[model samples]
Target: MELDSEIKDRSRESPSPEVGIDGRDRSASTTRPTLILYSHGRTPPLNPPPDLKYDLRSIPNPPKNARDAHDGRSKRLREHLLGELKFVQKLDEVESEILEAMEAKIVETAEKLENDQDRRDDGEESRENGEEEGYESLEDEYDPTEAVLRVGCNCALGHHRSVAFVEELARRKWPRNWSVQLIHRDIDRRRGNDKKVRGKSLRWGGA
Candidate 1:
């Protein structure tokens, strides 16, 4: 029954050397190749880290005060344009009314003048019809043909003959019915002849 003190002391101080089932030291054998376990049939689960999370509401929007100001400005501009349109329409109506009144006044004045002339013509016709027989009309006593004269001169005399002829006719009181018109030489040349001085002269002398 006596225990070995040395063996008891070694067991209490450290673990025993590992042994294979065959009674050989396990550490003295070669190491086994490392085995990597992979989950080939399933995809990796997606788990974004906490630091990657974002808050969209943190971004700033346009100021509410500025938006309200822009809306008010647009409304005022629209109202101003509408007011101007109304004013222009009223001005156009006033102008049209004025023009219409002026045209009417002009037409009324013209009609009145025409009526006055017609009344005067009627009165003169009636007076003429009431006259007695053997009374001559004033127009019938006046002779338009007596106021004109006709004279001719040879072409060789040039315009001088026409001027002299007019002077002589005037001295004889023939100018009262006559007027001189120069017949140009070029005009007669085109007609295969030379120009001759010709005029109309009227005289009160016996024929």
Candidate 2:
């Protein structure tokens, strides 16, 4: 079936690509996976860590220019950071892993569901013969299509490299239909609290 039109929130001033469907019609009878992309810093751990986490601290920080560093969402900063060969290579590697992980998870879920169904079928026969208790129903079981692909990228500050990488990843075309939730967990962290560590990240400027 053809994909449904992008859903929009009426309260927003303009249509934002930040939230939208990636492929198939979610409203259709069949379910699809939802990929959550998170960008964060090292100080705090995510409540539930992503299934796959990529570290961007190895990638050198972008030039500290006021215009670009002042805003974490600046296109110029993204361009500068993305221009690095390391960044491109890392993105390609991460994308491939994401696809592999999602496909593996889907297959794993399908197998689990199949096994559950088989058990339930056997249990039903036993119950009919007054030999067994009630079995777990499909309603209480996992949905195969609900396989999740949670990916996180983190750097020193979570302002530039990690945030930009997640944003770029969120924008890419994926093989499967997905509902995406993009998050920058520590982008707005206060600079005052950040103690300057020698030879670590550049001076905390703006996120």
Candidate 3:
């Protein structure tokens, strides 16, 4: 009887078996992974920590002299306009080029979403192959933390750059479940009784 009791006690002390979808024992981690969407100078009010933070300025081909340190597919409006400073502000060529580039970039980014071979299973320490380029370990690469990812930016007028990117990212296929919420720092900063708003807000529907 005493031997049976000792065996029972040891069983209780031993770690519980946890098998992941890949049939390997899961790590001792039970944290929910997070994907943050934020901009510079516009942090969320609660100041929550995020596992991954992608600034709107870091994406390739960003508007010149706009990004401070780091990134994304922010509309290069200033660039489009500045290049046409010599011509009238209503230049059709500039508008067409910007529109075309923006559309192409959106499609390109979308296509690159699920192009990884093992993004799903390789998220844990039980990696089957070598580590990916941007990640340190399978744990760091696929850490699941139960936390809200705060995203903010210096979009003074709103509905131009950061807002657009957030909207676009929300539509992408993430490796994990991500509930994205947008909080335009200056959603109404540009609106007033003066009747001067941030001009036309472009609704990038399918474009």
Candidate 4:
């Protein structure tokens, strides 16, 4: 059999390829997906001849001295496999570092997604509650025949405060658009029971 070096040179010299790991030029097929696995730099018995078409190479985790998985995806898969093998195989510091970083990155991504989902849920809940509670709305509380101008006076409170509020409104030259009437609250019980006395307490002005 031609040596691995002689085969490599022949490949460069000619365009024809019979796919074998050592014989094939690494540069020509760097982007192919197949992961040809080896143990201690030798092929396994079940391995097929090198010329077969293969995709998605599954590389076994490399030793600590084995630095830099040549292809990007290959490196990731190697590190992931190393992490899985941690319990079975005792890993060195270098392998431990790579596994730890990978784990941290995964955890961080999960936390970020969870926090984003929680914020969206909270915002939706707050919006629904505001809609239910009628937030910042005065329409339902408004009354066309109601007046809020009030003052408390134990003596003739309904008339005293009621009249004063109307006078204050006039002093300010407020718009007189609504009707106003004073409904005395048990004024007859406090003052004389005579019809004239009760009639004096009940008065009307304008809003």
Candidate 5:
């Protein structure tokens, strides 16, 4: 999608990155659109890849022993990382990029709807005469609930830094109309071992 430059070019409106979470109540139905946030390790998911990626390798990690006791989902570990000033700055940067991408998607969807309406208007006369060509409609490609952005946050082992960052990101205020999905791909897969760790479901509040 050439997301960075292309999104900026197509977006007619620029929203501030500091916008707070929308307090409006929203349903998790097909009528509501989505914004996916993915957290992973060194290797990122290829299918349905992210529009923006943030590397968290530089963020300070907690103690080595902490990996055994806690993954990034732990509040203790999250605070440990957030305690660093540099990490907070990085988070701010990520938020700005995500907002910009979302704005682009909104603009693109509006344009698509407008174009489809224009096509229908032009074909009105032909339809009345029963001479309109059988052609696919642009409306078929429109999905009101499709995902607007897939943002990836990665670190050395998806268990720690990336998990914390993505979890924290989700808690922040977002547009009420947009739903955020968090995926910690490698959280169960630990380092130096292929064995998987089974744990309770990770809870995402107000997702």
Candidate 6:
């Protein structure tokens, strides 16, 4: 009994395992790690200190010869316009050829129609006079060729060129049996803006 009492007294005198720094009881520290932090909420100092001054220099200006720059720009603009004009002229020539071909086709079709009518009339007369057994109209034998006029424009300036070409072709009385199709390929792809003109097909029965 005396030995047990001595052990109990020693146990009471021992330092607690739950005590931490600054005399705070730390029962939670026994089960997990404890972190002791001291913060006064002070901002960090800037490197090199706030009293340091910076010396900045102005950027150099470009050459002040405005006439040279203007001349260069004007030359470029003239060359571009000339090249566009040449291209448009070529398109005009092609359009003229197409229009002429259309006119020839129209004349040929009209002549063929007239001849067919004459032949039909002759066949009818022959059938009535007992020279033939049946009268068949030549209209059934008509086989007209299909022609399509395709106009492609590649720039804003060329757009007007294409329109003029179409107008001239229309004025020339293109064949009723021919078709026309217009396409514009030059446009800013990023902006998604462009113009397209489609022509109606001209057939024998109706346009």
> Could you give candidate 5's per-residue lDDT for residues 1-207 as a string of tens digits?
232233334333213332323432222122334677777778635357778888899988888887678888888888888898878898888888787777665555545555666777777867888876566665566664454677888898688888888877776666555655677877787667766543233332122
The model with the greater TM-score, 3 or 6, is 6
lDDT of 3 by residue, 107-151 (tens): 333333323325554554344455554544334564233333343
Q: How accurate is candidate 4 locally (lDDT)?
A: 0.29
Compared with the true structure, model 5 gives a TM-score of: 0.72
Candidate 6 ranges with C-alpha deviation above 4 Å: 1-83, 133-179, 182-207
lDDT of 5 at 172: 60
Model 5 / residue 40 / CA error / Å:
0.7
Clashes of each: 8, 0, 17, 5, 1, 0
**Pairs in clash, predicted candidate 2:** none
The sequence of per-residue lDDT tens digits that candidate 4 reaches over residues 1-207 is 122222223322212331333343322321211112111111111123322111112223334344232211133433444354432242233224333432333344334445645666776788888744323433366432232222111213222222222222222211122122232232223233433222222222231
List the pairs of residues colliding in candidate 4.
19-50, 33-56, 34-56, 34-57, 35-57
Against the true structure, candidate 2 has what lDDT?
Answer: 0.64
Better of 2 and 5 by TM-score: 5
Between prediction 1 and prediction 4, the one with superior lDDT is 4
Q: What TM-score, to 2 decimals, does candidate 6 have?
A: 0.32
Each candidate structure's TM-score, on Cα atoms with residue i matched to residue i, is 0.21, 0.70, 0.30, 0.20, 0.72, 0.32
Q: Per-residue alpha-carbon lDDT of model 1 for 1-207, expressed as tens digits?
A: 011222222222111352433454433222211111110101111122111111112212224553334321133422332254433343344334433432333334334444545665766776799843433334355432221111222222222222222222222211111222222221112223344322322222221
lDDT accuracy of residue 101 in candidate 6: 45
* lDDT scores in order: 0.27, 0.64, 0.36, 0.29, 0.66, 0.32
| Tens-digit per-residue lDDT, 99-192, candidate 6 | 5544344444444555756777888788788787364444346443332223332222222223233222232333222333322222112123
Native-to-model Cα distance after best TM-score fit, residue 110 in candidate 6, in Å: 0.6
Clashing pairs in 1: 147-177, 148-177, 149-200, 149-201, 149-202, 150-200, 150-201, 151-199
